[model samples]
Target: MGFLYQLGINLAALLLPVSRFFSPKMKLFVDGRKQSFAVLENQIDKNQEYIWFHVASLGEYEQGLPVMEEIKAQYPEYKLLLTFFSPSGFEIRKNNKIADITIYLPLDTKQNVKRFLDIVQPKMVFFIKYEFWPNYLYELKNRNIPTYLISGIFRKNQLFFKWYGGFYRKALQSFDHFFVQNDASAQLLKSIDFNNSTVNGDTRFDRVAQIVERAQPLDFIADFKNNTTTIVIGSSWVDDEAIYLPYLNNSENVKLIIAPHNIKEEEITRLISKIDKKTVRFTNYKTEELKNADVFIIDTIGILTQIYAYADIGYVGGAFKTGLHNILEPATYGTPVVIGPKYSKFQEAKDLVALGSCLVVHNTEELSITFNRLITDADYRNELGIKNLEFVLKNKNATKVIMDFIERNI
Candidate 1:
């Protein structure tokens, strides 16, 4: 399996150059990796002590950020080397302030891993969530680097839990500590005799809680909101929009803010065509236009977290399509959240649903009904909002769990 994994990654590395022409995202994956070795060689200073943080994409980056930021603040002597395996994470956060340098993780083959580790020479390492490259993990273990898995989740179905997964299970031993999100994950590790783990909760709760603490008010959102029951539509997909747009178009005395998943001009234009009410785009929104508009579309990124703070109710999208967007972001701000039906897999989503803090709507009518109930009953809406807030509060300090160990060890 290890040999097969090696071959698979090498094949992927080889094909990346040819496959890049087929898609823009593929191009980014290929092109960004091409520059990674150069970026490290040029920027990474040999004298400075460095700690590494690796995330698969934007979501894991958010999950890992509180710990990264705290390390940056408290341990300024150690520089951060942030790496992303996906283009979506790297492109958006390459110039992020938290890390001294950011780059795509070079394809996980033996040669690349050796070269990367040689150049990086990190004092400690962190891998967010669950992208476990066998060669990298084994090499880090060989080097005796204290590698950690933060906000990690494991299930019975994963490779590590299978009888045929001995090669992959060995990779799990590379981590000096496993600051996992739940008991099931810890139990899974324990079942494999890898008990160097803890049920530390999800770091995202900590990240969002901190956002609510220090988030600056976006004046435009406040002015557009006009103190009404504003329903924030975050990271919406087409299917999600289909469920909510009818309620938006016909409803009054409530404002609509749509932060679609794709902000591409074509997607935004198509979305605008469906909305029968006055709409304004965040990029080109005029004060008068924004004030009068019933729908405000966020055609940009990075500010979505802050926007959740002003939401009376939040409809976090993607559950109807690929997956759910971050409901915790709005929920942390004491906003009642509504998501689509396909949320049984995510633990946080399932917990919120069971607690009646997060509403799940299967169809357009269900969405409308959910929105109407929240809009009509302030007490009920606030109650759900309070529950969501309490959930976020209760689950926070995962970062502290990680940092406490790091401090004692460092």
Candidate 2:
């Protein structure tokens, strides 16, 4: 099994270059990692001690950020090294100010792992959420490096609990401790004889709460909203648009702001064509022009979190296609959230749904009904928004708990 796992990793490395010719994303993945060793050697100080953090993508980075900031504050002597496996994470956060060095993680082959560890020689390592690189974990373990998994969530259906999961289970044992998001994850670890786990809740709650506290006012969004019933469709996919576009086009009193997952011109153009009413891109937005537009399409990034603060109702995207986008972002702003039906993977989404704050719609009809209901009933919307805010407040402080544990251990 170990041999097979190594072979799989080797195969991926072997085929990455070939895959790059066909897929731009694959090309970015390969190109970003091409100078991994060179980047590390040039940037990392050999004499300085460091703490390494590995995140799969931007979402995981957000989950681990509060803890990383806390570590930096307490141990200013240690430089932070952040690594991302996905191109989306690396490309978006390459200019991140938190980490002293940010680069694409080297491939998880044993040799690559060994070389990476030697270059950084980190005092400790933290793998955020769902990233499990077997060779890297094993190498860190062999070097007696303190490694932890933060904000991790596991389900019974995952390979670690399956009948033929020995190698995967071995990978699980490489972590010194598991700071999981829920008791179910802790119990799942217990079932596998991995008792070094704690239900620390989710650090994302803490991150979103902080965002809410420090949310800067967006004057453009204020000008666009202009005291109308504002519906923010955040991180929207094509499927999400298909469901909500009709409602947005027909509704008169409400203003709609869409921040699509892909801001590519073609996609944006396609979205604009589908709408019957006037639409304006965020980049070219003028305060005077906003009054005439029914839909405002955000063509840029990084302002989605702050935009939520101005939202009366938020329709988070991704659930209709993949899984779901961040409902917490809107919930933190006391905006009643509406998501698709496929939010089973996110416990926070489920909790919000149970609290009657999040509305889960299965199709266009359901979405239309839910959207209209929230729009027409101001008191109901306000009540749900309050519950959503309270939910975020209650689930926070996971970062403090994880930080306390790290302080005691390290």
Reference-based lDDT, each prediction: 0.91, 0.90
TM-score of 1: 0.98
- Name the lDDT value of residue 373 in candidate 2: 92
Residues 1-410, candidate 1: write the lDDT tens digits. Answer: 87788788889878779989999999999999999999999999999999999999999999989999999999999999999999988888888988999999998899999999999999999999887989999999999999999999988998898999999999988999999888988988999999899898999999898888889989999999987779999999989878888888889888999999998999999999999999999989898777778999999999999999888999999999877878899999888999998886578998999999899899989988999999999999999999999999999899998999999998
Where's the lowest-lDDT run of ten residues in candidate 1?
341-350
TM-score of each: 0.98, 0.98
Model 2 per-residue lDDT tens digits across residues 1-410: 88999999999989889999999899999998998899998988878999999999988999989988899999999999999999878888999999999999989998899999988999999999889988988888889999999999999898889999888888887899999998999999999899999888899999998897888888888888888998999999989988998787778888999999998889988989999888889978778998777889999889999999989999999998976988999999889999998899998998899988999998888988998899899999999999999988998999898888888988
Q: How many residue pairs clash in each candidate?
A: 1, 0
**Would you give me the overall lDDT of model 1?**
0.91
User: Which RMSD values do the candidates have, in order?
Assistant: 1.1, 1.0
The pairs that clash in candidate 2 are none
